[model samples]
Target: MLRRLALTAVVSLAVLSAAAPGAAAASGPLPLPSPLPLTLPLPLPQGEDDARTRLTVTVSEAGDPSAEGIFELECAPVGGDHPAAEPACDRLAELADEGTDPFAPVPRGAMCTQQFGGPATARITGTWRARHIDAVFSRADGCEISRWNNLRPVLPGVR
Candidate 1:
């Protein structure tokens, strides 16, 4: 029968394996990857930090361009036309130190409260930490409200 043939083959394989346990090792050792070299960052040039953290923020209500307000922000030395430049820069620096990306959007399929915040929206464009950033923000829902609140002065005070 087919069952007998399968059982005989299984027993044969078991006997062969038990008879030569070291046969597998005779193929030789496997090649291992070499360890990578460690690298350290060099010091930043003078004025480099100041040059890397500049942004333009534009806020509007209900998608109305007429109501939009635009402002420039420069960190490091913290000079700009923003109403709360120092506070905004300080908050942004705190985020960077904590390894948080303020411009990240809400994750898909995330559970959030159904409450609506408002129709206010904002756009931030420019460079931060030497990387280009162009992010849009809105207080349209609970998740968005939390995101906006976390940025504080960087986005603008809105309820």
Candidate 2:
């Protein structure tokens, strides 16, 4: 009788051990603890593009108003009173495509030629690729002249 009872207990323990995982699953998964509050920025919609490129360009000579001019330029569709809107827009687009900031300034402490370009100065302001742009151009030095010339047609030729 004693042996039989011991055998029965052993068999029952084996059966229970085998069924333990299945029994827990059958009873359904345990509830997960609630997550903490999280703040996530919403993503922009698909097909959306950066802000339109619209700008006001002002060019002035130190002592010559006849050489001074102000023009509004709108790009992406290329409109406004700019004389070379299409070409200007093309140059800006090319710069952006190449991951270069067209309005970026010359690096500090870098060597530049001491050549003087002239007394022409220009200011460009407004938006490009959704960022505020307020850049100044001048032919004060070689680096400045190169910067001004690179953005051609955008800044009318000034000699």
**RMSD to native for every prediction?**
10.9, 21.0
TM-score of candidate 2 against the unseen true structure:
0.65
Candidate 2: tens digits of C-alpha lDDT, residues 57-136: 99988355654788888987888998888999988877677666768776776556798888889999998776678999
lDDT of 1 at 18: 84
TM-score of 1: 0.65
TM-score of each: 0.65, 0.65
Off by over 4 Å in 1: 1-50, 62-68
Name the top lDDT candidate. 1
What are the clashing pairs of model 1? none
Report the C-alpha displacement of residue 57, candidate 2, in angstroms: 0.4
Candidate 2 local Cα displacement, residue 107, angstroms: 1.4
lDDT against the true structure, each candidate: 0.79, 0.78
